[model samples]
Target: SQQGEEDPQALSIQEGENATMNCSYKTSINNLQWYRQNSGRGLVHLILIRSNEREKHSGRLRVTLDTSKKSSSLLITASRAADTASYFCATDGLNYNQGGKLIFGQGTELSVKP
Candidate 1:
């Protein structure tokens, strides 16, 4: 499968702490996207890095991609309770339409203690 797999089924960190999550995939992809899901809420797009790009960042989030190894990592610096949410990585296949049919992995549940 071209799906991405994230490590650590869950995580808990104190407010102001940093949290890191890693993902690994099995096939080549046009791009990879990271999303945040708050409990029952819908997933929110966080960042997207193309296969040609090595890294990208948004606010307190940093993401890195290594196509050779088929892996990606997400880093949240200075995490807050508000930052607590489930994170997932999805692959955008070679085709745009195909990419839209995202296959999400078992996410990493994050809890930020206030």
Candidate 2:
């Protein structure tokens, strides 16, 4: 599978702190996307940065892509208990002839203690 894998399967942090997670993918991709899920809820798109883009930000969230290594990193600032959730990284293949489906990584569970 050309899916990504996230590191630090679980993390614990205090409110107002920051959380960082890493992801590595198997193949080249046109773009990478980050998502967050609150428990049983569906995943919500947090940000999407194309291969041409090295970094992207959405509010307090920052994401960086490194195509050479087929990896990416996500940084979340000002943590809150409400921010506790599972974070996942996905990618759309680089080959134009390939299907456009997004492949998801095994997510990292974040716990923000208030």
Worst 10 residues of 2 by lDDT: 93-102
Model 1, 1-112: lDDT tens per residue? 5387899889999999999999988877888989999999999999999999999988899999999999999999999999989999988778666637776777899999
What Cα-based lDDT does every candidate model obtain? 0.89, 0.93
The superposed Cα distance between candidate 1 and the true structure at residue 26, in angstroms, equals: 0.9
My TM-score estimates for the predictions, one after another, are 0.93, 0.94
lDDT of 2 by residue, 1-114 (tens): 648989989999999999999999988788999999999999999999999999998999999999999999999999989999999999998777766889999999999999
Model number with the top lDDT: 2
Q: What is the lDDT of residue 58 in candidate 2?
A: 91
Clashing pairs in 1: none
Superposed on all Cα atoms, model 2 deviates from the true structure by an RMSD in Å of 1.2
Model 2: which residue pairs collide? Answer: none
lDDT of 2 at 85: 97
| Candidate RMSDs in order | 1.5, 1.2
